[model samples]
Target: MPHITPCLWFDDQAEEAAQFYVSIFEDARIGAVSHYAEAGQDIHGKPPGSVMTVSFELAGQPFLALNGGPAFRFNQAVSFQVVCESQQEIDTYWEKLSAGGDDAAQQCGWLKDRFGLSWQVVPAELSDLLGGPEPARAQRVMAALLLMKKLDLDALRQAHAGG
Candidate 1:
């Protein structure tokens, strides 16, 4: 068992979320579904045997989702990032993730989901250059990222080298 795991707090629909996630990613599976007991209080108007927690794996990382009432919610402050090697991959993720035409950021990322979860779709090289040691180079890359909805490494490099 992983000593540490990220647990997601959903208003309800924990099982539905788990199923949705597992269906989207390869190498993913739903591990467990804990349903509310007959003696437990009805939550979300669900039946006593309805799921209260769902455990699943995404890209091989274990995550837990709880039907923990409305105590917490997802926001842009914490987002999952998908790094792509080419524009094709970027488009694929963007299309699937932003299905409902949710809000998009100018820097080549968008937030959308069947469940309203936010995601950042970035080019792999952008993370490489932005995290590189050269400050000037990194700044140039950042500038390039600012103008694009998806990162373009060639343009960023050209700008960095002042070409």
Candidate 2:
């Protein structure tokens, strides 16, 4: 079967965004880089030899970042969800991805990174809590989550425990 890789569109920061993502995730590495050629310069308006695309892997998942100019921008409609095993992991990802980001955009584990990419730094326990047998607890968890920016696992747990 052919692999399906996610391609991210960036105004002109494909290489920079790829490197930033690689630095934040474990087991990430930069792969092949393609530069824009003179042939498409007339249409694309990008300088020849400039970075056109950057192939990279983040935690073993392949991704492509394209320097597609400022024609498109990222919005909240689509986001990358990062499942975290612990609060510390969530904190690390939140801090790294949200650095220089819009503070107002953060809520219920969702954050917009500096590059305008949206990310959900979610805790693994959230599913179990939200999908447990008791729907009341799930409601409580949701209520607690809605009140904060970055999710607080302890608060969710407390809400689940009927605190």
Candidate 3:
């Protein structure tokens, strides 16, 4: 299968965003960086030799960050999910990614990062807890989840147990 890479459009912050992401993910690294040339100044309007694109990898997944100007912005409709094995992992990621982020956008383990990117920090067993065989228990878990910003594994388990 052909390798697919998600390209992120930024308003002249592609390099900055790529660096920030590389700092956050342990298995991340910045790859090649391309600069704008005078040839496309009429269309792109970016200064010659300015950063135009940055290639990066996060957790082994390849990505591209483009300095596409302010024609677009990130929204909650598209989000990156981080499945953590423990509460500590979730806490670490949540704290790091949510720093300088929009507090008003935080809900149910979902947050808008400083760069306006959406992220979901969730437990690894979230699917099992929210889609268990018992519909009532799953509903309870869902209720507990909706009431929380950062998910509590213990509370979810308790809700599933009908506590």
lDDT of each: 0.73, 0.94, 0.94
Off by over 4 Å in 3: none
TM-score of each: 0.79, 0.98, 0.97
Q: Kindly list the per-residue Cα lDDT of model 3 for residues 4-89, writing each as its tens digit.
A: 99999999999999999899999999999999999979999999999999999999999999999999999998999999999989
Q: List the residue pairs that clash in candidate 3.
A: none
Question: Lowest lDDT 10-mer window, candidate 3?
Answer: 125-134
TM-score of 1: 0.79
**Better candidate by TM-score, 1 or 3:** 3
Sort order, lDDT high to low? 2, 3, 1
How does candidate 1 score on lDDT?
A: 0.73
Candidate 1 structure quality by residue, lDDT tens digits, 3-47? 667888887878878887777666889998888776746435656
Off by over 4 Å in 2: none
